[model samples]
Target: MTRGTVILKNGKVFIALGYSNSDSYPSGEIGQMLVKALSNSSDEETVQIIRELIGGLQKDEFSKDCMESLREIGEAFYNKKAATKVGLDDVYGYYYDYSYVYDIKTRKLQIFHFGQLEYSFKKEDFPFLRLVVENDELLYTLSYDTKNKCFKGIDAEVKKVKRMKKAGKSPQYILEIAKSLSERIHYVVDEVYSSDCWPNAVQKGVTFYPSRKRLKFIFKENYGKWNVYIQLPWVRQGLIHNCTSRKAAMNKLIAYLDGNWESFQSGMDLYELYEDCQQKLMNFYNACDQISITKDEFNESVGQIEKEFRGKLIPLEELDYSGWTKAFGPDRAKKEIANWIFMTHRHIFDCIQKA
Candidate 1:
């Protein structure tokens, strides 16, 4: 049996790519076509052909092993300087094991974002996917490792439940899935403490925060992976830090309770405060560009400000420029409402001043 070479981007598995013959393949023609497909990352068409060759064989021992590697090597055509050689370098060629690619991606991803957990389909019909969850995070790629043969990273452990179906384009649905998964992992240790988990009053004594500020763990999705962090009322911004695993997340939550966590910023109700500030800022900004300032100006200015900041004392009644009463002067209207709003915000609470 004569041969041709199918060089792969990865060279971890340097074994012989079987010679062409009539039994498994018609000739070396099939081999060259595979190389082309892999080079282009031709998803559907190439994947379909490779499927027939692999059939039901274990990945490492398949007849179409080298060609199957197109799943990974095909990511970007095989360039010697930037590729890994898979299978043996006979005339028949090399292929990707996807498992090797998964490992390589895992190592490379750690260099950039340790929280990234990337995964993808290695073959068109292959039920198992590749997964890569980077360090200290209950990280695994069902799409990197065999979520069944799941890997343990620095601070996290991973397992694959059934693939999420509702994790579609819906933000609310995805958030729900993330919350469920995160809390399920949390309940394993700290009564649903981490994993995008919400802080609950545990018997009024066990609290995630020393203050009444609600500390919610956030698994903010970054691309396909998640940027796992916390959302605390005291935090001025999100993405406080990466929580690599379920256990690590709980440990950090403990830090907050123990009054030891060093956050980027600290103040109560920061997100809501930011929302209020943004609304007011935009209202002021829009007013500045207006050519004329009359009823429209009042509508935009007084209307928006009142809408956003409703006073605890009294509602912002509509302006009555036409029927101005002598006793209820304009100065008091501005003082009791607008000035009060400003003063209430300006007055620094002791907790904030101390913090």
Candidate 2:
């Protein structure tokens, strides 16, 4: 059978020359030409060539051996241009054994292997191909020797590729998980708030954040699990809760909202402390019957009652307590009642000031 010469320049098959049908491809002049063209071509031209070659491979115009040859040529071109080019090309093509597209604009690289896109990376953000292959114990290995024209370890690479093909592909469940989590978050937010609170008290869309403040409740995927974080204003490291599933994340979010709501109501009650104290004292006295009691018993009862007034003293701090002390002077029962109120109020006031 007659031999063929598929001359690849940069990453593309610049010319395919042959006299007749070929069983095997020639390498001498064709390889030299490819190396020379790759060396001389600009980064943009090389990227375009890679794109076209990938397109051709996807079309299945070449055999597996031919595709491997093309990939080696493409990698050589990449090695030569990688050092100098700040912006790389996103070369899209078919996956034979493995293929990669390095995007020029985004500086992102996507790797396809075993008929699926397996990995993605940012330029300079990851180790070199050979290092990655060795470190990660990848099935196929990359060659760093740019001078070697022929595809190295073709037999072994093909065997590995075949084995990998036999092994069933792993489904990407993270995407489905993300979608489910997003929908669940939207639904939960809508259910928690009334229509009047929408776009005011709570805002929901692609993400959920408090409209009044810079606080944000962010959900993101970490490793294989969903992570929930409450980002507060002026805080670099926000509160984080790592969850194994979407259900756990949603539950955590609901709990956070419930706790926050309760705290908010408690804060509002502080402003009405004076009226609340009066009402509580009136109710307590009305409930009490006119009966003789021991001094120790009355003191013990007052101590129990004082617990209710502990945190409600913010509104009573500025009020004059001297009037009550003077009015109840020399009367043991009245003084005991007045002293209980004074002590509870004073304790809470001291705690608030220290805080």
Candidate 3:
């Protein structure tokens, strides 16, 4: 059982429902306050209580009314694209957006949306809150108790989380929740793009697609600027590649592959790749340093490697099924990840080169 709590940062509040034992965390203070506020609110009037609480916050800590404020934060984060020089989104990190409860007897996963955000496709300042007008539902209530009684509510997200543990499920991983929610929100955002394309219709300045060459890249169009990310196919928590204006997130990822790059390029088949392709990459890495390579240079260099490797290499689409580093231990996962990057990255490049 995982629970959610709203954390206040720099006067802005982010939801952190998945955190357990809040006593040791810095966000515990706000998390405690939020739990207190939610537990004390009128059981029959959750939405109203949230609104009243939000309306009662001070200026410096404006996010007290988190549900309403998230819309504002999202707008502020995304609206930068309209400017000639877009700034970084203020709310960049993962937030606890949803809580899951499991029944020991039934083994069912009940998902609860954390704040007023819709958690679905909707057009408005904040995607989640737009659902308020469409339905008379309360925020932060567990799925089981949501339909139970209007007055019944849990004081802490940990209440359900405890039961989940006994039932043999540990609700951990802050990034896991953040990544899952972010992906869902992105889906909603995508629908808006294909159809509504918020703040304005027919928005065409930004686009995203995979690479079509021998390497994997996420071609990104921000406003009118273009960049690419070296894709780490094994990563599940969202964009593993970080990006700056001049370079993609590949620099860091390339560093992870350094040992293998060295070994393979040194005429040693570290992971049994097709000999021909390894020889080509050996030549490339032996002759060049990736740290100084630019995107166009990378594109130009792909041809020879692609010609040699291409489909001759087998791809490890997924490494584990148990997940949460279950297939292998952490060290083993790390090794496999490095090998996977060397073997599979170019395949993504082959798929999206022209797009």
RMSD of each: 19.2, 27.0, 19.8
Model 3 CA deviation exceeding 4 Å by range: 1-31, 37-42, 45-49, 59-245, 252-355
Order of the predicted models by lDDT, top scorer first: 2, 1, 3
What's the number of clashes in each of the models? 32, 2, 21
Query: In candidate 1, what are the lDDT values of residues 1-355, reduced to their tens digit?
Result: 3222222222354222222323222123443333333333445554444444333223344436545654445433222223335432342233221221211221110011111222332332121111111111222211132111112241122222323222222323433433444433211112332333333211111211223233344444343333334432223234324555434544554444333221211322333443464457455545444444344554466546755544421322333322111323233433445544454433322222333
Query: How many residue pairs of model 1 clash at the backbone?
Result: 32
TM-score per candidate, in order?
0.28, 0.18, 0.19
User: If both were scored by TM-score, which would come out higher, candidate 2 or candidate 3?
Assistant: 3
Per-residue lDDT of candidate 3, residues 42-70 (tens digit)? 43343333334333433333333433544
**Candidate 2 stretches greater than 4 Å from native:** 1-60, 63-95, 126-128, 134-355
Which residue pairs show backbone clashes in model 2?
Answer: 88-104, 89-102
| Overall local distance difference test of candidate 1 | 0.32
Which digits, one per residue and each the tens of the lDDT, describe model 2 over residues 77-108?
22324312433223423223333445555544
